[model samples]
Target: MSKSLLNHILLLVLLFIGIILSLSLGSVSIPFKEIIKSLLALSVENSTWDYIIVNYRLPKTITAILIGSGLAVSGLLMQTLFRNPLAGPYVLGLSSGASLGVAFLIMGAGLLSGILGEFIFSKWAIILAASGGSLLVMLAVLSTAQRVKDTMTLLIIGLMVASLTSAVVSVLAYFSNSDDLQLYIFWSFGSLGNLSWQEVGILASCWFIGLGFAIFCLKNLNALLLGENYAKSMGVELKSNRILIIVSTSILAGSATAFAGPIAFVGLAVPHLVRQLIPTNDHRILLPSVILGGAILMLICDVIAQLPGNENTLPINAVTSIFGAPVVIWLLLRKRKLNF
Candidate 1:
């Protein structure tokens, strides 16, 4: 068997292990055997364990998998599109756009007690606002992509938009009450366990559609690694491909941010980690490897965030950034440069 194939198998094994660990080692520890039974829809001896396993852990695990793979794939898309090591899924200001929408909804909340207020303050409102904000940015980026001849200029435009939105958010925060500010702050910390099955289903739909776009652009992505001129020479339409890349990224990153509240670092780190492991530039290999790597990393991070049997769970964003940064730093130091 090829070495890459062997590595892929190993990653799959790690993912399976991570899933089991995530399911079995929560605040109330469930046994591996019971987890397996619950997964298979078999009755467990303990009803409480069964309920926890079937309802909470199952959905959360799926969420981790989706968030990880989506962000990682989005990061890979951004990195390849920009041909920059430092570029991340949020480079196009998608996350900032999301934060902007959510900030307005929470900080500018004019509603207090009525049904309208309840609807405005509901979780769905946050999700809607975030999605709306991301879509606005996506449209802006798409329009900009069509007009700009230089890719670097598009990146700069995205940064400017992000900065502008952040400034607006700051203004809103300044005018907001303490309670609203605290709510916004907590939202930024990110979460994985809060998703319902319906929300998970929505998240998965976004993942699938985004990944479908990624798969469609696989060849364009590979050709892009050489250079835009090379890709164009190979008959890749740069403008259309660029829009698709941005769209895919916006979908993946935007959905994750909207639902999970802007969890950090996974999109930026997973591709690099997978590249180091698999040592390939081929998108066919890179995409799947990054998917598995991202999922496993997220599952592990989620498990760590849960603090395993402790009632106190860390924020998902905190755990990802806290642990991911050091590993990425060590990898770069060891290699003395980025692989890309």
Candidate 2:
């Protein structure tokens, strides 16, 4: 077998192992046998175990898979589009923009219970707010990117945008009641377990559409590796490609931030990690490898967050940053340069 094929198979194996571990090894340990039984629809001695596996564990596992794959793919797109190794979904300020939107709803409007008055939070309202905020930031970034000559300059602009939005959020939080502040704080921590089945369906659908766009842009992406001038010489349409990339990224990153609350590092770190493992620049291969790599990383992080056999869980964002920051640092030290 070819080395790439062998690598693909190994990644698949690792991903399967990750899925099994994620399903069976949480705070309440479910035996591997019980997990298998539950998945197969076989009767288990304890119905509660089955319920926990099917309802809680299953949804969490699916969320991990979807978020991981989506963020990784989105990161890959940004990296390729900008020709910058460190570029990620957040490089365009999408996450901070989403946070700003959510803060407006949760803090500015006092949506949380006991904040100022009795009010129930609506999931759709939050989603729409988050999406709208990120989309607006994306449009602003895209416009600026077109005018910028240097990719690094565009990246710095994104950081500036993120900082500005964060400042806005801070001001909103200061004026908001304590209860509302707490609500926004919890959302900022990020979680993988809060998604309902209906919400999952929406996330999954958006994820697939984003994936479709990525796949369609594979050839354009590969062409871009040779630089924009070379790509245009080969008849690649830069404008259309950029628009598609921005749309795909907005969908993937927006859905993830809206649903899971700006979980970090997966997008920024996963593409670099996958490249280290696969040692290829081919998007066709890198794409699937990144999806698998992201899923496995997310599963491991989720397991760590659960603090196995304990009642308490860590924030997903904290765990990801703790584990991923070192990898990114090491990658930078070794490469000592951006590919672009």
Candidate 3:
């Protein structure tokens, strides 16, 4: 077998193990045997164990997988589209836009209730707000992309747009009641455990469609890596591909922030981490490799955040940056140059 194929198979094994470990090692620490039994709908000895597995852990596990892979793929697209080693999904400011959306819902919902009604108070409301905010930013960026010739110039516009949105969120927070402020703070810390199956289904749908865009653009992505002029020579439609890339990024990054509350480092770190293993610029290989690598890393982080036997858990957002930042630094230092 080819070496890359062997590596992929190994990664698949690791992914399976990560999923089971995430299921088994939460605060209550269910046994692996019981986890398997519960998953198959056979009763565990304790009803609470079954309840916890079905209601909490399963949805959470599925969420981690989606958030991890989706964010990583979004990062890959950004990195390739801009051809910048430092480029990431957040560079486009979709996260900030999503944050602004959720901030309005959480901090300003009461003021808008008479005008917009109670729709802002629903569970799905947060997701919609975030998506709507992201859509607005996406439209602005798309408009800028059309006017700007240089990709770097377009990236700069995205940064400015992101900054404006972030400032607005901060202003909203300053006027918010303490209770609302606290709710926003906890949401920013990020959570993978509270999603219902229905929320997961919505997140999963967004993830699927976002990935479909990335998959469709794989050829253009690889061609664009060398240069846009080169890609043009190769018959890649620059404008259409650019839209696909941005829209895919908006969907993935936006939905992830919406559901999971702004996970840090995963989108930026996972693609680089995969490059350290697979050593490829080809999106076809990098996409799947990064997807699995992202899911595995997220699962690992989730396992640590659960704090095993302890009742208290670390904030997942902090845990990701804590664990992932060091690894990324070490990898870059050892390599002495980023792959891309």
Candidate 4:
């Protein structure tokens, strides 16, 4: 088999292994046999065991897969759109926007004498607030992008936006009471286990909408890989492509942040890793690889976060950053130059 096919098979295998490990080896340590039996409805000692499998582990596992795939693909699209290897979902301040929104709600409620806290703390309210923040930032970026053709300029603008929002978040954080501060800090760390089936369904819907948009942009993405001028020569509609990319990326990154918080590095690291492994610039090949590679890494991260055989789980963001930051540094050091 060709290298791509072999690599694809390898990723699938790793994904399967990761799933099995995620399901079987948490604090309670359900046996692999029991896990399989529970999944297949063969047998279960009690309803609680089934609840552990179906209600908790299954939803968490699905969240990991979806968040991973969505963020990685968003990063790929951003990098391609900007032709910058370092560009990612966070690069455009999208996640920062989500963070700012959550900060506003949590902190604002805390300062309001607990009157609106109940309403603001609702799951849908949080998700909606985050989505709105992300969409607002996306619009700002797209508007600025219209005036700036240089990718580096666009990147700098995004950084400025991130800084601005971060400063606002800091101000909110400083003024907030200890309880609200703790809540915001915990959410910022990221979590995959808090989602329920209904929340997961909403996330899945947003993910599919974003992924569908990305699929529609595949040809334009491939063309733009050569450069905007070349892509324009090839009949790619630059303006339209940018709008669609912004919309898709907003949904993907926004929804993930809303549900799982701002997951770091999966977006930044996964695409580069896929490119290194597959050695292809074609979006057709790269997109699926991006999804699989993302899911695999996320599963591993989630498993590690669980601290198997123990009750304490690390934050998903910390695990991803610890694992991803080194790969990025090594990649940059070895190449001595960014392809973009």
Order of candidates by TM-score, top first? 1, 3, 4, 2
Q: Between candidates 2 and 3, name the one with more favorable lDDT.
A: 3
Give the alpha-carbon lDDT of every model. Answer: 0.91, 0.87, 0.90, 0.88
- Write down the RMSD of candidate 3 (Cα, Å): 1.4
State the lDDT of candidate 1 residue by residue for 1-340, as single tens digits: 9999999999999999998888888888777888899899999989999989878999999999999999999999999999987788999889889999999888878653354557877889999999998889889989999999989999999999999999999999999999999999999999988788899999999999999999999989999999999999989999999999998998899999999988889998999999888898999999999999999999999989988768999999999999989998999899887778
Instruction: Give the Cα error of residue 298 in candidate 2, in Å.
Output: 0.5
Worst-scoring 10-residue span by lDDT in model 2? 111-120
Please give each candidate's TM-score.
0.97, 0.91, 0.96, 0.94
Query: Cα lDDT for residue 317, model 2?
Result: 89
Candidate 2 lDDT by residue in tens digits, 1-340? 9888898899999999989889988878778898899999999879999999888999999999999889989999999988887788888899999999989988878444556343336767777778889988998988986787665677788899999999999999989989989988898999999688888899999999999999999999999999888998999877778778878988998899988889899998898887766788989889999999989899989988999889999999899999888876888689784333
Which numbered prediction scores highest in lDDT against the true structure?
1
List residue ranges in candidate 4 displaced over 4 A: 111-117, 146-151, 328-340
When sorted by lDDT, best at the front, the candidate numbers are: 1, 3, 4, 2
Q: Which prediction has more favorable lDDT, 3 or 4?
A: 3
What is the Cα-based lDDT of residue 328 in candidate 2? 69
